[model samples]
Target: MRIGIAGWFGSDNLGDEILLHTLVSCVRSVDESASFVVFSPNPDRVAALHRVDAERMPTLRARGAVGRQGTAQRAIRDCDILFLGPGTVFQERSPNLPWPGTLPLFARIVGMARLARTPVAPVGVGVREGGTPAGRRLLRVIGAASVAIGVRDQRSGSYFGARAQVIGDVAYALPIPDTQPAAAVEEAAGSARPTFALSMRPLAPDTEAGLLLSIGGCLDRLQADGWTGDFLPMAFGQDAQGEDDRDIYRRAFGNVLGLAGNPLNDREGTTLAGALDGWLTALAGYRLVIGTRLHAAVMAVALGVPTVAIAYERKVHDAFVDLGLGRFVVGPDVDAETLHRTATAAAGSPAEFREAAGRVARQGRIAREFVTATLKGLG
Candidate 1:
């Protein structure tokens, strides 16, 4: 069997790479003989790293009419089925980015797959809240094209209604090493002050001042409590400079530790690029984690780190709920005093948090099963 996957992969975003890697690993667990042909933005990098045949994802302008042929058409023809999985699939807006949206791009993907007579199954997809009228219609077309659909959370299901099964994040199901590096764990415990991991992304201009002030204030309170933090960037843009999250996080904390990286995009640490297990292992070493990115929370929970999710988007909120860490989530507008209290409460509740995270990680097995079942039907 051959599976063709298309997503925002190889874009210098570790979170998306983690999602892609986990999905590929899970599929192979069910069918060792299966091969993959991926459609990626950076096809050469993906092909080399993933050991798969890859082609550039279709350009957004190519309309998939009855007789036209292109890269997407040829790849779709070769695969038994096409999958739109992982990452924030249906987001219509970005905080500061200038791109229009994904609706039209996905419409073309499903359209090309439809023309090629290959089934398009959307599994482990995230649906962002709020959509334009035309975005809504394009989504219906994509849903109608799918053989089966699995959404990342209950809130994501609202967009697709009954057709979208609530599949937990497949990335959460990604396995981590059994133990963290002793040095990492020792640093967290052996240091004079406890240290937490912190992650954030770009916010709208209106929200930045208030959010930064509160975040700064919260870190100040943690300082009083003898705690320190590190800023970890989940994404490093392909443009050589780091992503906005790196900058935002820099402004949020005065004395936070941050690793310097080159154009290599290994924002976490050296030897961490494209390695989910390694990243999770480093995350496990932290006494606590507070992050605005959904996967930052996802990765943290999977490692059973005490976490506070600052929900910059609804998907982050929904994911924490799915992880059984609902109470740890806060909106971006959260006040410093409340955030300080929440952080202390989380730090105090490690055992309970670990228990909840383990339960949810166990449940993540269903994601593997769902994909296996989807493939079984296709076979």
Candidate 2:
């Protein structure tokens, strides 16, 4: 069977890449001989990393050229099933204005599947409010076109009523390295200073300065308390649009002591699994993680690391709450002092945090089973 998987893959976003890797891995486990053609912004990178046939995602104008039978159209036409999303690709928001949002591309993909008489399924997708009318209309079309829609959270599932199953994030299915040391126990055996890692992404211009100040102040307090800080950038490269976590990290924490010249930035590789493995391995060393990226927080918890989530969006908030770590989340309105206090308290009880995270990780396996069952059903 041939599967045409499409979403935000091969964009140098570690989280999306990890989810794609996990999704492909899970599907392969169920059907070893299944062939895949993925749609991605960086098709060469995706092909190199995932070892799958990949075509560049069709641009808005390219959709108009569908009559000419482009590479993307051909891939979709040949597939038996079209799989869409394991990320926040269903949202109404678009980074660029005066342009069609992501929904149009989604609608176009489903349209291609419909024309080819192929089943389209969305796995571990996320949905949010405040979408444009065009976006909402496209989402409805997508919902009706899908054979089965699996959402990553309850909020996303509500959009499709009973058809959308809440399957949690697919990244949970990613295999954790067995060799990583115990969370807090191993830290005690290390040096006197406990390490703290901070992960941040770009925010709106109006709120960017304030958030940076708050994060810097929080990091300062942690440093004063004898904690060494490291900035972990989940998304790399300019192709990631405005969600450049590395650039944001450099702008916010570049000069901060113990954070400057950290080697984590140099650890990523061409392969998605290798990059994720390196990230998780490095994150396991931190006693506390303050993360704005949802996948970064999820990955940290998967490795049994204590994480304090800074919820810039509902997905981040919902994921942490589902994991039973709601107490560690601070909203966008949170002040610098509150962030410091929360991080300090969260860092103090490392054992409790680790235990809670471990419990959530155990529950996340349900998502994997759901994926396997869904794929088998498709067959």
Candidate 3:
């Protein structure tokens, strides 16, 4: 079986790359005869970063911004099945460069599949409010896909009718490294001072300069509450590509906190793998997580740490809601007191929070089944 995956496959970001890794692995596990074709913007970059050989595997150039129209059409014509939105395909964007706006390409591919009578399925994608008429229409077109499936919470589910299936985030099924993470966790947990895991992406449309000030005030409030704030960089591809998370954070918090002994300095330029290790390590030690990165908060939950999700978009809220962690998410514009209050609430019942995380982890089992069954059904 030949399956074509259309999403953020070859990005340097660990979180986005892991979606492809997990999905491809899951497909192979279910059917050894299955093969995959990944359409990546930077196939060479993906090859170097993830050590994935693009030529050996079924690959075609279908990068959104770089214009891979011919290759994408050809691949769609050849593949037996098409998968869209495994990663944050619905949310990934840059100022003046909204590559994801090429979402219509997926719809067009699905349309081509329909013309050819090939099956299509969308897995683990999110839905959010759109800003423009074209964006909304494009969303409806994607949502109305005949064989599309999604994993957003019930709130996001409202965007699509019967066609969209509501499951859990596929990130939950992300393969744990064979090497045990317990030692790293234990070491960080043994830290003498109160530590925090602060994962922020580059300054995006949702995150402004004021975010740092708000966070700085939050740090002072935490200190008053008997905690020390240590910023952890969950710098994935955005930061790896030289996007500044702390500079944005500094714009908000630098004046308030004085920038003395900031921990982010140690983690500024690390690769995604290194950052992942650091995230796990800090989770073992931090009193709580206060950050904007959705996947970072998910990592904290996976590690059984108390995490306060700061929702810059609806997907973040949906993630927290899916994990039954509605109380853990705060608005982007939340005040310092609100941040402290929510963090305190999340940390109040650590055991219960851990229990909820375990429950969230169990959702991964369902996700695996969902993909396996969907692929088998298509085949």
Task: For each candidate, give its TM-score against the true structure.
Answer: 0.89, 0.90, 0.77
Model 2 CA deviation exceeding 4 Å by range: 62-69, 97-100, 179-190, 257-269
Cα lDDT computed for each candidate against the true fold: 0.75, 0.77, 0.62
lDDT of 1 by residue, 1-379 (tens): 8899988876666777778888888888988888998887677667666678888767754455333337668879889888897767777866533344776777788888888899988878887666777776777778877898888887666666578887788886787778663336766567766778778776776787788888888988998898867787777655324355667755655356654232235333333235555556667777788888777877877777788999988888877776667888998999999998998898888886778778667767888888888888986
lDDT-wise, the better of 1 and 2 is 2
Question: Model 1 off-target regions past 4 Å?
Answer: 61-69, 96-100, 180-184, 187-189, 239-242, 249-255, 260-274
Name the candidate, 1 or 2, with the larger TM-score value. 2
- Among all windows of ten consecutive residues in candidate 3, which has the lowest summed lDDT? 256-265
Sorted by lDDT (best first), the order is 2, 1, 3
Q: Candidate 3: where is the Cα deviation over 4 Å?
A: 51-67, 91-100, 115-117, 131-145, 176-190, 204-207, 224-229, 236-285
| Residue lDDT tens for model 2, 192-272 | 777778888888886777888888888878888888777877776536568667678666677773442222243334455
State how far residue 330 of model 2 sits from its true place (Å): 0.6
Cα deviation in Å at residue 140, candidate 1?
Answer: 2.1
- Angstrom error of the Cα, residue 299, model 1: value is 1.0
